[model samples]
Target: MSRPRTLTDWQALAARLTPQLQGNAFINDDFVPAVSGETFECLNPATGERLAKVASCDGADAEIAVRHARAVFKRGGWSRMAPVERKGVLLRLADLMERHQDELALLDTLDMGKPITSALDDVAGAIGSMRHQAESIDKLYGEVAPTGEQVLGLVLREPLGVVASIVPWNFPLMMTAWKVAPALAAGNSVILKPSEKSPLSALRLAALAREAGLPSGVFQVLPGFGHTVGRALALSMDVECLAFTGSTTVGKQLMQYAGQSNLKRVFLECGGKSPNIVFADCADLDRVAESAAAAIFYNQGEVCIAGSRLLVENSIRDAFVAKVVAAAERMQPGDPLDPTSFMGAMVDSTQHERVMGYIRKGIDEGAVLRAGGEDVAGPGLFIRPVVFDGVTPEMVIGREEIFGPVLSVFGFETEEEALALANDSDFGLAAGLWSQDIGRIMRMTHRLESGQVFVNNWAGGDQSMPFGGVKQSGNGRDKSHHSLAEYTQLKSVWIALS
Candidate 1:
């Protein structure tokens, strides 16, 4: 699909791509609402218009979905399918996603205010993730270990029955694929609860799964608020495992719910206030500045691993700051439907207000508002890229995860001070270091508290690399073969020989 240039073209493209649905949850391969017949409006953040009414699913809906998932698992429908058969279905699903890439992108853009380019990237990522998991499960084998001479020990990986995947609004489609593809590949019945802020993509993905020949009830999407349906799913005794990607606050609550219920295994990829460190010895200041802008401004800075904090070496701080400001100025927030727009609106008015509040807090804390600290002049929930200079670690903006296009700059004199500033944060999901010195790169790689560190680049990796965080940023890895471990259980058996 070619890029839609004008607003008229964009509107026409959206109409062609998106399906007009009567708000309902995708359960057991059918669209239906909550037993109570409750519904909620899904608003277009870009225009603040009601896009559609989605099912306001609650505990009752969760129960029905769980029972359906359990029944399907017990019937040996998807769980007992041959590995090759499962792989074929997933590959077909990926193919379907590729064929309808434009539609998927439009659904995500309309639903969550993500820029069309980024939404398209999410679609590509979802396709790749599904294909990666599907390919991996087919080739992987259980291990046999030698015990004493007369016996053999074998370790087998088994699916954890029914899994509940609750994903965040940001990167809706990608996060869903990150959790669901691996769980489904491991032969588990999956019940997905996508964030109410962005439920369209998940619901559409469920439709594609069924069209790709997945067994009925094998995969389901429940659209509703997090407090009700999300809590119900978390507290369900039948849900064997729960995989989530969201805020640290909600992630902690889900963990407690898991312990209180069936003690279901929980895997989370939560919040981050990641630091991007740039040393004076780094020669590529231009590229560094470009990446720095992209690091914090992409997706309107709603990324969990966004480089919100910048720790720069004092010697080159001024030059780097100027370049970064220029880069940020070039990337303005605009209409999400336009393919040329680098930044888009916030997920909603609530998030927009929250981000503006953070900006005000930064000013109150006495940091210099260097650039783009206010909401854009026009309508919609659009906020310009904000950069704060002379920031102290004690300030709320420096320490907190704003989850917006806000960047805080801190200057340090030495490597020791830089490392200290980077590691002082309560969250450590991801960090970035830019330096030409191999020794500094090697040292920082070992010293940084983050789970993943980018040497020169910022915020990018493929499905092959594992992604997660440490400390308050949550636990467990996503994307790679390691993610399979989250959805599977290990069984060890000893066989006696003659």
Candidate 2:
């Protein structure tokens, strides 16, 4: 069906659409169960209903997928395809994604408990990424190294045989495309392991890839747990590159797995305790307040780059925090199927409890509860947007990556103090500062330890920018041509002229 027009229309469509569960591991262009025929339950977090029985793939399943990926990579069907030819196939996949937008968006909303509106946005972003990476294929050129007339030196980029993308359930479709598009653009066979919490859209994506003319064994979707399927991929010699977007703990574990096995190249986009600093500058407080609320509350505050730590200058801290709390109050949790819902349930019961624990820890450690820190009494895994005022930099909530809609507010006196508070965390994925002073913006961006800095905004950025971080936030860029190039290896050739 076409894009639903009204809220009623979307809600009605969601009601009628049942998840046509794909509960098998895909390999060599076909679906197959684990050797033991094991399966696990997939629940709808918003309603706490069983969505499907997903495949419980293990090391055996990973072996099957990896073997097929290796065979296809060596055969050079996708690996050696002409750049223009590969571009067309990816473009066709993008078109198919557009055609099936409604279904994909619906699956993500139902599976992960994100608002339908945000699910639609994620689906659209995924399609755009596919198209953008496709367009870049033919435009890329190999370089001729500068050398003497007697020598001809050439440098070319080639695919790194097989890439395994391990994506979290937070924004399933978008993150999967973030890794898969670039890996495929570089002409590598890809094995995608979507989070067991939400694997429906990824399963459906594999079907679209085959429909768009991906050759056999070039792509597969394995739905399983991190310990089994994820660890297996990290340990598989056939899987050359592992790209992951998850927590710092799991990211570290995967790195160890890589070291224990084949020493495969691992790129991790992990945890963040980003600081959102607001100053008493000559600017609009209302805009800053709204942006600050959305930064920590968007996606139920499950964002990796969420500005969880808010450092406000002492002069304007009270008024600014009040306005921010008011903005959050207006954005309440609602049914994920409802189009008007800006906030939805946590991804699962475990996450809901984890968030509540952090909120309690903040209060125990002397941070004042400012607003809306209670659990929503309902069937779904929902928590109210929480704000902890009078929070110090040493508080657990201020230092840890809670990964929920919980904000820790801190007061700072001067620029030096603000920088110190922002850079004190072990994680440094992103940081935001609200200031009109151009000099201050430039200085903060330079001095702050975060990888991405936003002067007056938070989280929304162009795909052309390389996205990743240093420190415990993990390394390696995810988006842009830089990511596409990372999936490939550089080969240098030299010839001596007679």
Candidate 3:
């Protein structure tokens, strides 16, 4: 479906569909304020305008939500539902999501400052994730282990009771669905705590889940700071499993919380400073350059797996840098509601300041700024696509995950140097290498330390592929059949007949 582009057009659309302007934490199929009864303003980064007041939940709210989810799981209303029945509800939820894509997209755009086009893609991905998990629910099979002649052994996967989903703000609804769908498909009740920067879509999702026949307390949304509700969920004894997608620092803290509390199963998909390499023998330099720019600039570089470090072979270093710089020039800050807007504002003032600090560090480290080093002055929190050359591995910009639209360029003469430079980071979430040589591709594929490597492309994957990272980038997969196992526990049943 087509949507309005201009601000005036969007204002008219908003008047007709005011879409829960103010939202509260969703629990037991209803919306309610926190026990503290405090609220915070959700601002539009594009215009710095107050969109709505969101509930500021704390440890008190977390206690109530966890207990309710535990009760629901014990009651067998949802946890004991047949696989096919659970699949049906998830499918219906996807359908309703499709029906309300416009509203959801707008909410995401307003809440997170993502381009409307990007927000639409996020909604589509969220729907796809739910449907994919739904279809895989009943098809998943248990195992029959070999045993002695008189003994039979069977291994079954069972739900882990209550699960907590803590997702980041970059892909709000999609990330939530990636965790929620698989956990729910495994017959577990979920308590989702979305990033405080963007929690509107999660609240909306809970309402849709209830409408699609999800039993009370099966799915809940808590909107608050990570230190409060998120930490509470991590420390809860009743939450058997916790799935989190956010910063590496917070991921480590959650792991500690799990140990300090009930020692819950923790699955984390954390930060990345992914590398994008370009070889001299590449057939299409223009396409590679365009992809390189898109890789780092897309979504204001808020993506966890963004290719922020660009390594080009010395043979094509100058030419590739020029092409990438020109492409970066085209991505400028624009109104997120406008469909044609290619780039949007940062999520908030704090993130905006953080990106600026990185840009300054790059300049201070003697890296030459090829393009866009300053902020776009206006009512919104917008930064230009900053590209820096002459960056060294020891430089702060090269070593840190700036988490913004800032690219660091490096030149390597040999394949060995490129491999060394790419693997020099503490993160191993993802990496992108562009080379047509089959032997080179094979060599890099084997040697790269990252979890997911993209050959001749940037960060790209579907729900069918397993997605996760290693090392400081964190552990456990997010998508595909492997992810379903994260939420389920294995039980071995042995039978003997004499």
lDDT by residue (324-430, candidate 3, tens digit) is 99999888878887777778999999999999999988998999999999988889998889999989999999999999999999999999999999999999999
TM-scores of all candidate predictions against the true structure = 0.98, 0.98, 0.98
Cα error, residue 157 of model 2, in Å, equals 0.6
Q: Candidate 1 versus the native: TM-score?
A: 0.98
lDDT for each candidate structure: 0.92, 0.91, 0.92
Clashing pairs in 3: none
Task: Give one digit per residue, the lDDT tens place, for model 1 in 60-125.
Answer: 999999999999999987898888889999999999999988788888899889898899899999
Task: Report per-prediction Cα RMSD to one decimal.
Answer: 1.2, 1.1, 1.2
The TM-score, computed over Cα atoms with residue i paired to residue i, of candidate 2 is 0.98
Global CA lDDT of candidate 1, please? 0.92
lDDT of 1 at 208: 89
Model 3: residues >4 Å from true position, as ranges?
1-8
Segments in model 2 whose C-alpha atoms lie over 4 Å from true places: 6-8
Position 443, candidate 2: lDDT: 90
After the best TM-score superposition of candidate 2, give how far the Cα of residue 46 lies from its true spot, in angstroms: 1.1
lDDT of 2 by residue, 1-498 (tens): 567866687777766766456778888899888777999988889888888888899999888888989998898988999999999999999999999998899899889999999999999999989998998888899999999999999999999998999999999999999999999989999999999988999999999999999999888999999999899999998888999999999999999998998889998999999999999993899988999999999999999999899999999888999999999998899988788889989999899899999988988998999888798887899888899999887788989999899999999999999999999989999999888899999998999998899878888687788899889999999888888877999999998997
